[model samples]
Target: MKLISLLFIILLRFDGTTASLVKESSDKNTVYVCGSGKGKRYHLNENCRGLKSCSAKTIKTTREQAQKEGKTLCGWED
Candidate 1:
């Protein structure tokens, strides 16, 4: 009983750690967008379907700057 509980706790801890790591990794690979509507950051190659339309000039900007532009821009991989 004690050993089973210990194992369960360990498993739960490991699961939490894995979840956090996954989130962090995903965030690291993402680009942030600011301006227009609520303004939010998105991952590379993710669709920007509903956001405000952006121009080619905005698309050419660095990921961080693009985020500040607040317009729909294609992800780097796109």
Candidate 2:
């Protein structure tokens, strides 16, 4: 089972699909985002510069929840 998982990961990397894998894995990780209607980004760190401009309340949630709300990764996250 472990070998299969490893092979799947390797194949995902070879095909440049690691982003999906990473996202899938990080779905459960805590992320921060603005709670306003205009909010459209998720930050791995609560103090990310991207959240500085947010006038609404900052909320912490799972990355998956943020994505479900149409939020993308904050530009500053890179």
lDDT of each: 0.47, 0.82
What 10-residue stretch in candidate 1 is worst by lDDT?
Answer: 52-61
Give the alpha carbon lDDT tens digit for every residue of 32-57 in model 2.
Answer: 89878688889887778999999999
Estimate, for each residue in 1-78, the C-alpha lDDT of model 1 and write its tens digit. Answer: 999988866676579875554554456435534333344433343234523354322122256665565544444434
**Which stretches in model 2 have alpha-carbon errors above 4 Å?**
1-28
My TM-score estimates for the predictions, one after another, are 0.21, 0.61
Residue 1 in model 2: shift from native, Å?
A: 32
Candidate 2 — which pairs collide?
Answer: none
Q: Could you tell me which residue pairs clash in candidate 1?
A: 33-67, 34-67, 34-70
Model 1 spans > 4 angstroms off = 17-78
Native-to-model Cα distance after best TM-score fit, residue 63 in candidate 1, in Å: 43
